[model samples]
Each structure stands twice: as structure tokens, then as C-alpha cells.
Target: MTTFASSLKKEIARVARKELKDELGALRKASASYRTEIAALKRQVRELQVALRQTSRRADKALHTVAPDAPAESPKRGRRAVFSAERFKAQRERLGLTQKDMAAYLGTSTLSVWKWETGQVTPRARFLPAILGLRTTGKREVLQQLARGAGGATD
Candidate 1:
């Protein structure tokens, strides 16, 4: 009876040890899976931060162009203006002409010239030819083109 009891106790101890070993293996697998998930989350966070920065830059550019009250900074890269009111005004003034004189030369009203100078209005598509022609051919061809209904001149 003493030998049978001792053997039974040994069997129970062996079964408990095997169960504990299996539990430990399962815990280790869970821990490794959690670690992988954490690493993936960190990488996603970094990618989102980069996307946020790019979006912010584009927003800043859009705001600067649309808002006249925004602080003036140096021109951005790869931006070009086909026409500039300030440049036009400066060039006309340098040529010692008043708005009325320039308007008469360009075959437009003085009010239109004033609007162009003050940035209240921009040149129309039909007027672009006249403006460019004025710059190139000294305003004579501009009126001639308007008279002929050929509103724009070719480059």
C-alpha cells in the first residue's frame, strides 16, 4: 500500500509539470504575437506623421496664394505668373505714362486701366493679345488687332 500510494503521487506530479509547461509555451506565443502587433502600430504612426506634414505644406501654399492678408514670403519654387498687375503698373510708370494715356494707347477706357493697376480686375482673354501686343509692338498693333476683331496675337 505504501508503494502504490507513492507511485500515484509521482504520476500526479508529472501530469501537473506537463500542464505547466504547455501553459508557459502558450504564454510565450501570445507575448511574441503582441510584440509584432506593437511594431506594426509604430510603423503606421510614422507613416501618418509624414502624410500630415505633406498635407500641411500644401495647405500653407494654398492659403498664401488666396489670402492677400497673409504675410508675404519669397516666391515658391516652380511658380510663374503669365501676367502681373504690379509689373505692368511699374513698367507703364517707368515709361512716364498716366493710366489714361496707357488706356488710350491700349484702346480701353481709363477705368479699365485703373482696375488693372489696382488689382480689382484682371485682363480678359480677348485683352491678353492686346496687352502682349502692346508690350511687343508698342500698342499700335493692339488697337489694329482689336479693330480687325482678331483679339489676340500669336506668340
Candidate 2:
């Protein structure tokens, strides 16, 4: 009778261990899948952070550096008187530009520039801003503008 009872107890213990092994196997598989998904998410986050840093550097460069060929900004005022025939001629001569080059830079005809310099005709109100913009331009910038064909004329 004692031998029968011992064999029955051993059988029950073996069955419980088999049931627990099945449950633990499923749990382990789920844990591994979750770990792989988390690794993918972390990799994506790192790539986005690197891209954001590159974009920030580009924005900073655009904001801080001014181009040498760009014109200076003029202050806004109530109908500022910024153009005169003599001043126009002087600005052209100061940049060592001929009347033809001046006309191209200002996007006008050479005859019109000649007339403006001789004070025979006043330039139209439309040309005032471009004429005024030349006042602060340097000689090197003027030459560069001419070389690039200021009025869209190709060399």
C-alpha cells in the first residue's frame, strides 16, 4: 500500500511541471517579440535626431551669413527723395561704369541714361528705387553685376 501511494504522488508532480512548461514557453516568445519592436523604435528615433541637427545647422548658416553681392536694405520713410541726375551720374562714374553698363545695371536703355545724365529728361518714378540701390554698391559688386549681365543680357 505504501508503494502504491508513493508512485501516485510522483505522477501528479510530473503532470504539474509539464503544464507550467507550456505556459512559460508562450510567455518567453511574447517577451522576445516585444524586445525586437522596442529596438526598431529606438533606431528610428536616433535617425530623426540626426536629421534634425543637420537641418538646424543649415538654418543657422542661412540666417547668419550675408551674401557679398546682395544689395543693402533701405530704411522705410515717407516719400524719401533719394534720386537726382547729378547723383546718378556720379554713382555711375564712381563705380567706373560707362553709360551703357549703367543702363544695363539699371535695366534701362543707354539713350535714356544719357538723357538722365544730361538733365534733359527726368527718370520715371519706376526707376527711382533701383537708382537709389546703386548708391551703396561697391565697385567690385558693380563689376560682378555687369559680368553676370545685370539686365538679363548674356555675354
Please give the CA lDDT of all the candidate structures: 0.66, 0.76
User: Model 1, range 1-155, lDDT digits (tens) per residue?
Assistant: 99999999999999999999999999999999999999999999999999999999876544323343433232234443244566568657765667866776666778998888776677666565556444545445544644565533332
For all the candidates, what are their Cα RMSDs to the real structure? 11.4, 15.6
Per-residue lDDT, model 2, residue 149, is 74
Q: Evaluated with TM-score, which candidate comes out highest?
A: 2
- Name the weakest run of 10 consecutive residues (lDDT summed) in model 1: 72-81
Tens digit of lDDT per residue, candidate 2, span 23-59? 9999999999999999999999999999999999876
Q: Tell me model 2's lDDT, rounded to 2 decimals.
A: 0.76
What global local distance difference test value does model 1 have? 0.66
Q: Could you say which candidate leads in lDDT? A: 2
TM-score of candidate 1 against the unseen true structure: 0.37
